[model samples]
Target: MKISTTAQAGALESNDVLVTVMPNDQGGVQIQLETKRVIFKQFGKQIEEVVRGKVSEMDVDDVIIKVQDKGALNYTIRARVQTALERALASGTRD
Candidate 1:
């Protein structure tokens, strides 16, 4: 699935992640993640892996994902990204 426009999902609440999805002018998916947790250095790679996996599973490509992580668990990240993608696709369809 290709992202047709900019979209977002999730909240800034604790233990949650806010995800923003946008169409990329270039090729392939680009993920930008931000986290303030002390364990970020250790868990950053895992977090990125989860996001990439989720996007690929949705068959999405050539998009930019911006994530603001608030110490969320892996499941939370997955859910947020999924929800964001769905919202983006749905909105794109409407337009």
Candidate 2:
């Protein structure tokens, strides 16, 4: 799938994650992540893994994902990413 516009889901509230997605003209998936300093040291890789996994699963080849995590679980992260991607897809121009 291709992301042709910017979209977002979730919130910055505690235990939730804010996910933003946009088109990447560079032709690859790029992710920018943010979280608490302490939590990043421990679970940053895991959180990034979940995001990457979801993007891969959706077959999105050219997009940028920005994740702001507020101590969210893996499921929450996945859901937020999926929702953002779905919205982007829906808003994109059809080929």
Candidate 3:
């Protein structure tokens, strides 16, 4: 799916993650992650893996994903990313 505009899901609350999806005309998946320094040091790779895995599973070739995590679990992160991707796909022109 192609992301035609910016869309987001989830929030900044504890145990939640905010996922934002945007069109990436340059191609390929790009991710911008935000979290506490400590959390990044500990779970940064895992969080990124979750995002990339989900995007790949959904068959999206190009997108810009921004993740703001507030100690969310992997499932929460995946769900938020999926929701945001769905929204972006729905709003985009058909491929």
Task: Give lDDT for model 1.
Answer: 0.91
Model 2 per-residue lDDT tens digits across residues 1-95: 78889999999999999999999988888989999899999999999899999999999879999999999999999999999999999888654
* Residue clash pairs of candidate 3: none
For each candidate, the alpha-carbon lDDT, in order, equals: 0.91, 0.93, 0.93
How far residue 51's Cα lies from its native spot in candidate 3, in Å, is: 0.4
**Lowest summed lDDT window (length 10), candidate 1:** 36-45
TM-score of every model versus the real structure = 0.94, 0.94, 0.94
By TM-score, how accurate is candidate 2?
A: 0.94
- lDDT at 64, model 2: 91
Q: Write down the RMSD of all candidates, one decimal each.
A: 1.1, 1.4, 1.6
> lDDT, candidate 3, residue 14?
94
List ranges where model 2 is wrong by over 4 Å: 93-95
Cα error, candidate 3, residue 63 (Å): 0.4
